[model samples]
Every structure is written in structure tokens, then in C-alpha cells.
Target: MSTPNDNPVPTVRVLPETLHRAAAEVFGGAYLIGPVTDQMWERSLPMYRASLVQGIVEDDGVVGGVARSWEVELDVPGGRVPAAAVSSVGVRADRRRRGYLRALMQAQLQTTRDNGALVAVLRATEASIYSRFGYGVASTYATLKVTRRRAVLRPGAAAERRLKMITPEAAVRELPAVYERIRTARPGTVSRPSWWWAGMVDRHLHKDRPVWVLCTVDDDDQVDGFLLYTVNNRDGWDDPQQAVVEVLDLRAVDERVELALWQAAFGIDLSEHLLAHGRPLDPVLDLALVDPRAAVTTDVEDETWLRLLDVPAALSARSYGAGEPVVIGVDDQLMPDNSGRYRVSTDGVQRTDAEAELHCEVGELAAVYLGGTSFTQLAAAGRVRGSSEVLARADALFGTPRLPWSGTYY
Candidate 1:
């Protein structure tokens, strides 16, 4: 009978510059996204080639499993820190059950930490695959639906909003600056790179459907916010009567500006329905409507899976809510440097030698890292090991004024 020690470790290697497309090819098939064409690879090279790429190589010198990440600045509670925006993670169909996935994840994480990134984040295609790798659901989003005809703003709901319509090319030129100004409003926001902007506009420009960018300008003629969307017929091209307006992206300097943009969406001439995909679970949109029931939330799920590479550095970067200090212990199997006791309070976080009043694995700790979940909630599911008093203190210390939202989808 074979035992766990019978098998040998799979070889994982960093792909040379010429073999980067092999990583993309494996990922394309593993995800079943689309064909790995030269055009697509060229579009993607700007994002990851300058960084690093790793994979498991087969006997023929082709990649069987691949993982790669891009660099970005992550907005924490009080400030922004460097983060690895991971993507293109996949393994070939024949490579399943041989520890390729585990090897790729471990190597990538070690490389991220060694390269000085404190945190890493990714949007998972499968929920169960990442937790064992110390990745947790740090943010969640929902698809918000609104019947356009039924969405009527309350009196004085939308202020004197000044807006302008622009072509896709103009939006590509202007909206990144707008996003930069408003991204600080949320804790989990990330900066979009030039590649992100270029890809976005190119896709919209080449499509048959029309895309519009509506911007709200302030009294001084400064661009305060914008919404990018396209109108589509849900039933079919023949049934143009059922027009659905899909908002791909929206950002605002404040709630008033955001509310005005929603109002404009409702005002689009001939749309029957409006859908805002991957939005934070905020009631502001519902409240602005006269009935508050006009907007319904659907498909609420994980938005970003966050993993800490340098736990102490990640913890010290974010600000916490008001609470007394509490000692929390984390046992990280993958990254031993992250295994320690951390004392946290409104003042700051510090490494402590005191006895831990609460205990959890590194993944479990990350689940509450952005205040997206609470210790009391996790304790109910037996994920948190702590008394009621200590659990409450920990929750208070990690809480944020608003839920963390990573608006950018990689």
C-alpha cells in the first residue's frame, strides 16, 4: 500500500521570457475561457510580463499548471499598501490530483513575500480551492437590479447634477484620473493600471453595442465622478424592446454624486431594466428611490480572496476601530513567518508575547481582516476559538465604518 510519503514533490519552475505564452495557453484551457490567440497574449503581456510568471513543466517542456500576478496599491483603512493582484491561475485537465495546484500556490506566495509585497488578492473561480492556501474571502459584492420605469427619485434626491456624455475613446482618456480621486473612499479599492484602461476601451470600442461615459462636473468644472455602461437587449437582437442597461463601472466623490449617476441611469431614454454588477452591498441606491424596493440584490458572493504574505506588515498598515487591546494568535501552516501573537487596538497593532485570548488559523484571521466578517459570526460556525467577551473586543477592534469594497475586477 502506498502512503503519503511515497510520492515525490512536483517540479515547479519560473518560465523564461519566451515560454510565457505557454502559461497563458494552459490557463486558457484550464479555465475554458477562450482560445489562446496571439492577439489576446499581446493584450495581456503588458500586465504580467514585466513582473514574474511561474508554472509546473511537463516532460515535453510545456507548462501543465500556471499562476501569475500583477502589482497594485491596495487601500486599507487608513492608507494604501502594495499588493499582488493575482490572476490566470489554472491547471491542465490531465494535471489534476498530482499536487500541481498546491505547488504553484506555495511558490507564488513565497515569491510575493520575498519580493516585499505584504498582501495578495485574487477573485476565485472556485470557492473551495484557495482556503487551504491561506486565502480568505475578504470582500463581497452583489448584482443590483432596478426596473427602470419603476425607479423614481424622491424629492430633492438628486441635486442639480451637471453631466456630459463622451465617446469611448474620450472615456479612456479621462476616467482613470476620476477613479484615482474617489478610490480612497473605500478600504478595499485598488489602483487600475494603464493596461487595464487600454483593454477596457479596446473591447468596448470594437463591440457592436454602444458604450457611454456620463460624467458629473463640479461647479469649478472639475470631473467629480462617472459611470460607464452599455445598453443591450436581453431577449435577443430581434426583441429590441427589452433593453437592459448594464453599468460596467461607476465611481463618485461622494454619495450625492453617486446618487445623481444612478438617477441618470434611470433617465436613459428607452431601457426597461438596469443592472449594476459587482457592487458593494450598500443600501444607498435603494434608499434614494421613492419605494426603496425598486432595487433588488441578486448573486451576492465573494469579490476578492485576500492572503497575507507579511502578516505583521499587513496588520500594521490598516487602522482599526475603537476597542481595548486584545491578544490574537494565528497559526499559519504555509507561511511560518506569519505565525505569531498580535496585540490590536484602536491605537495600533503590535507583536506580543502575552498569552493569546483568541485563536484562529491564518485564513480565518484574513476572513475578518477587512471587517467584512466578524469574530462573533465566525465563532457561531466554530471558526473562531474565543470567549464571548474577547470575541466582542476583537470584532470591535477590526470593524470599519463602511464595508471594504474592491471595485476593480481583475
Candidate 2:
């Protein structure tokens, strides 16, 4: 395609998988097929086939920039929100000065809105890059490491727990129920699709690496919890036997089931240390192990980036933590009215009246929505403009003592 400037806003058309691979390579080596193997292709193929909106800014038939969006169902404060995950964002080094990324984001966000999505998300390669595009940090995940010698198992009058070594096929049949039961009670958790569950069992557990699963059941023979993990033998290292609990998908409602699940993991004598990724802060692991202090907690960085497509509806979906009335002005570059002032009550009811106290842009609101970054922090960074008192009042309105965390990636 040719244009007046000769740069021709380049025909942004979707390419085949082969061309997509070539484009991914030209864009960068990190996004190659290594992380995405053929086995896992089924999991994401729908994103490419049904959900993907990919394009390239071509310069005389040569690729200059690339952008793609993965439509996803996200768990928000209100409920399951239709959303899109804008990922694999890349621009040719030569195309940096041009507005490629901005153009791509605008097109994708608009497309997502048109498709009835309420939000958009991504794990930003650089934190500062996405905010200007109206994306905000909405959630975080963590990886915690604890030494087997130090994990303090809180001894309480729980029940006698048993660990059963299960096959990947067995795990596939057993785990979803436990996970489904757990997410229903949890506020920030999202429902895992059947594809995700299938991937976990078939590819992860039954692969060449030979991952194992431990099922935890109480004396009544009820399956309440399970741990999907791998054990590594690190010879000559400070901690030799390392058990990395990649996904401790436990759903124990009672102390017995909880303790039994931990016992199942703790009973694995092959590893001297235990580490977990995507675990909630208040993990049942806190009750397992010898001296819990040995567990190293590094804030794992992953967030659900949010852009409010519908301001009033999104604002009214979830109730606030407290009952203080504050006026919030949302700066929405995409949706103008979302920028106006509205009174947010502690009970979760919102109104556009004369009494609105805290106000900021939609991006700032997105950053603070997950509770990882506070309104005060954004104000300090000059991302949100306002007085100290206004920022404080806003913080009081949105800040929660326990930060919101997400365990899944869209």
C-alpha cells in the first residue's frame, strides 16, 4: 500500500502463522516459538484465530512495526469483565520515532471496546510505557522461596493428612473441581478455562521433564486440595534439593484439608527448599514447613492492566472497602465523559453530583485499582495532579491495607 508521505500509514493487515513467526523473529528473538511450543499452541490459537487482532505497519511491503491483541475474560472488582490483553507489542528500531505503538494501541483498544469488552490488560515490558496509552496496573503476582529447614509449620489441632502421588491424567480429572471450588470464595481469583486445565495436566505434568502432582484428602476421603510441583536436584549448591512449586492450586475449605495439602508438599523428601509462583500472599504454605522465615518473598511482577470502557458502570460494579464519600474525576482520553467528576460513596454507589472529593485520570485510577500502587504514589510522581489533601483523601478512599493480587495471566 502507498500513501502521500510514501511511508504510507502502511497497510495494517493480519498475516498467516508463518508470516507471524517471521515477523516475531524480525521484531525480536525473545518472542520466538520457544515459550510457545506446538503442544501449547491449542491454548493460544483461539486468541490468534478468534481473539487476535494483529497487524503490521509495512513500509513498501517491508515490516516496520507489529501489534496484536488477545481477547480475554478478566476478573474485575465488579465481575467477570470481557477484556483484551495487548501483548507481544513491538516496534522496529527504525519505526521508533513514528507513532506506531500509539496507533496500534488506539486501534486495539477501540476494537476491543467495539467488541463489547469493558477493559484491556498487559504485563508491560516497561512500566512507564503503557500509562500514556491509558493502561494501568490492575493486579500483581508473586514468587516466594522458603527453605525446608526454615519453613515454620504452624502446629494446630488440624486433622491427620495424607499425600498421594498421582499421575498427570489423574490430576487432570481431579484438579479443576478443587480450583473451581476455591475461586468461587476468593475475591480476586479468575476462573481457569478448560484449555488451561488441560494444558496443566497433559503438557506440564506429563512432559519429558516428568512433573508430579500431590493430592491431599482428609480422613473422610474428600479431595479438598492438591499441589502441582517439580523437584530439582541442585548438587553442590547451598540448598541442594530445591522443590519449586510452580502452581500450588489448593482449594481446602477446612483446616484439615489445608494441613493435608501442605503435608503432601512437605512430605516430598527430595527437595530441601520450597518455592512457589503465582501463590496468594496468605498462602497455606505459611502454615507448613519448619521455620517460615527461610521463605524468601520477592514481589513477583505481573499485573492486569485496566482501561475503563464504561466509566459509570465500571465504577459502580464493585463496592468500596469503606463508607467515606469521595468525588473522583476519571481522566479518560478515549472516553471523554469518563473524565468527569462523580461522587463515590463508601457503600459502592456512585453519582455525578456537586459533591465529588478525589479526582484523577483513568490511567491513574487503573494503576491504583489493584492496590499495588497508591494514588499518593502517582501524585508524587506527577502522574496525577492534585494537592496533598486531595491525594490523601483519594488514598483513603481507594487504598486497602491488603493489596489486591491476581494469580492468573490472560
Candidate 3:
């Protein structure tokens, strides 16, 4: 094991292979695993970027590392724009608190900016760690635990569509169209490339051989939505009645199809409970349930963390609501170029020489950029500093008609 003081100022390098190995090591340490294999590394390489991979070397060995900026389009408030999805961030167990993580993050942010990505987004391993790096919770997800016995569709709910149970192979071939149709409908969603589909989506689907893929088709026989799940049978186990139908992935174009999918999951025989994890904040299931409490939302968590690398481009990409212009001062310590006063309005965004009505960090701005949280909420938390009138105006301008949701996890 390496000690922190062995190499006080660790050397940083961009080594894709070394970073990949070090990442596996960091993850093994993080998850209490002894080691990770090359096969695992090969499987995840589709999402890996050699240029974006950064590592800290000690005595010619990678001691800490991070990978990021997977080129992808993110659905912002009214439009889709280029974004860099940061992931696979980790540090060696023995290299903690040595500023390696901070150095890597700083380098990553600069690389993300240089890549011309308007925004930097991540699914944080630890919520507390990213906030200091100027990443704020940009989207939220809800976990649903529904009691199967009480999970009944509302009387007037739309009749079930043409649902077909297809093989995982078919699902891998067919579901991308359905996903593409709905990916941009919500803010914070990022496009899933073919590589992502194979490496992440298909890999998971193939893991559980008995996995069920239910596709919903329109009258014209066009695929609109799909549900990927598996059932646990505990016939000989102690709690025979405790079988669960777990939802691995569920996507639909509209509520009707979504309800149909939920009904199918609930209607699974011998399953006493239906659990859906990482669902959007919208309570479509709760509203469809005969007993609202049947689909109990056990937890809600931050799903997307966003950092503005280029404030001007980030602000300009998303459309704002109809409101008077407001000049807001942004303080971005990590990327000082993003620190400036910007006048935002429904018309557009631009750097302003005028006095600022509000002041906030880049993270705070990102928190409200997607319209998931309002300026008032951030102001209440002391994140946004402004007068009452300015806050109200900023809220109106930045707010969205629908809540921003990132349905896809990269």
C-alpha cells in the first residue's frame, strides 16, 4: 500500500489504460472487492475517453484517478445541448485527503470546458463531495415500493395497449427507438449512444436470463414504450408470499403507456410487491393506483448533479420563461472565466456591464438552470443572494412548465 507522504506532490497524467486499471482499483477499494478483471474493464470501455482520463502517479504507479466528459447531448429546458457527463471518479484508499481528487477535478473541469461542452453533469457517488466542486443537484428521482395486493389501476384508466413479451435480444434491437422518442421530452436527460446501449443497457438485460421485456405498441404496430424487469420466486423459501417484481427499466411516450406498463408489473402472478427504482419525480403510478398509498414513494434523491463550465453557453442553450431581464452575478472559483454578470430574459442571455441584482455560485445557478428547483428555494437556502423583487423575476424567467427530470442514468 502506498503512503500519502511518499510522493507529496503527485504527478498527474492522461493515461487511458493506467487510469482504467486505477479506476478499477479505486472501485474495488470503494466496494470492498479484492480485484476487478480486464473483462470488466473491456465491457466499460465504450463509455471511456482516453483523452479525458486523468490520473495521479506515485513512483510510476497510478495512485488516484478520474475519467469524464463523455460527449453527449443533454436535454435542457426547451432544447437539447451538448454536455459532458462526468463519471468513474475515484481515488486510491491510501491517497485520501492528499488533494489528488481536487487536482483531478480541477483538471477535469478545464478539460470539459476546452471540449466546448456547455455544461458538466455527473451522478455523484457521494452528494457532499461534489457540491464543493461546484456541482449542484440538478435533477431528482423517486423510488416506489408498491404493495401488489393494493396496486390496482383506477377504474377509468386507459385500457391496456398491445403488450408483447419479447426476448432480451429483441429488446436490445428494438428499445432504442422508444428511448429516443422520449429522451428529449424531459430536461436533464442525456442521449444514450449505441455504445452505451450495448455496454450498460444490454449488459444488464442479459445478466438475468429470465428477464422479461414487455413492449407496448400502438394500433399501427409501432413500438412506443417498454419495460424490462424480472420476478423473484420464493416458493420454497420461508416467506413464500414475499416475491417481488423488480423494475429494471421502464420508459414510455405518454402516461397511458406508462400506466399500462405499471399495470402489467402489478398483475404479475405470485409477486406480492412491485418495486421501481430511479423513477422520475412525477407520481404517475400514485395517481393511477386505486389506493394512492399502494404505490408508496419510499425515497426521493438527487439523480443529476450539474456544473456550469461555460456559463454563457449554458445559459443561452436553454429557453427561459417570459419575464423581465435580470442581471445575476456568478462566482465560479474553479473556472474563473464563467464568473461574470449575465442578463437573462425570455429574449436571450448576454454578458452585462450593468449592476447585478443577484449573486450566486456557479453550482447554485446550475441547480436552478434546469428549472428543477426555483430561485426562491435556493435563496431560502442562502445559495442565491438577491432582493425580493429580483428573486421573483429570476424565478419567473428560469422556471419551467414541467419539472426537469433526467430519466437516463449514464
Which candidate has the highest TM-score of all? 1
Candidate 3 Cα misplacement greater than 4 A, ranges: 1-9, 17-19, 49-51, 201-209, 232-240
What tens digits encode model 1's per-residue C-alpha lDDT throughout 1-410?
22244545667788887778888888889988677787788877876666578888878886889888777888887888888889889899987777788888989998888887889999999898899999988989999988877888888877567998888888777788878876654778999987788777677656666788899988988888899998776454454357788898888888878889998888886767788989998747877889777899999999989998999899999988887889999999999989999999888888999999999999888889888899999999999899999999999889888888987887
List runs of model 1 lying over 4 Å from the truth.
1-7, 204-207, 234-241
Q: Give the TM-score of candidate 2.
A: 0.78
Assess the local accuracy of residue 180 in candidate 3 as a C-alpha lDDT between 0 and 100: 87
Query: Over the full model, what C-alpha lDDT does candidate 3 score relative to the true structure?
Result: 0.79
Runs of candidate 2 with Cα error greater than 4 angstroms are 1-47, 57-73, 91-97, 157-162, 172-174, 184-187, 199-207, 218-222, 233-260, 281-290, 299-302, 349-356, 385-393
For model 2, how big is the CA root-mean-square deviation? 4.5
| Poorest lDDT segment (10 consecutive residues) of candidate 1 | 1-10
Which residue pairs collide, candidate 1? none
Native-to-model Cα distance after best TM-score fit, residue 25 in candidate 3, in Å? 3.2
The root-mean-square deviation over C-alpha atoms between each candidate and the true structure, in angstroms, is 2.2, 4.5, 3.1
In order of lDDT, best first, we have 1, 3, 2
lDDT (0-100) at residue 374 of candidate 2?
75
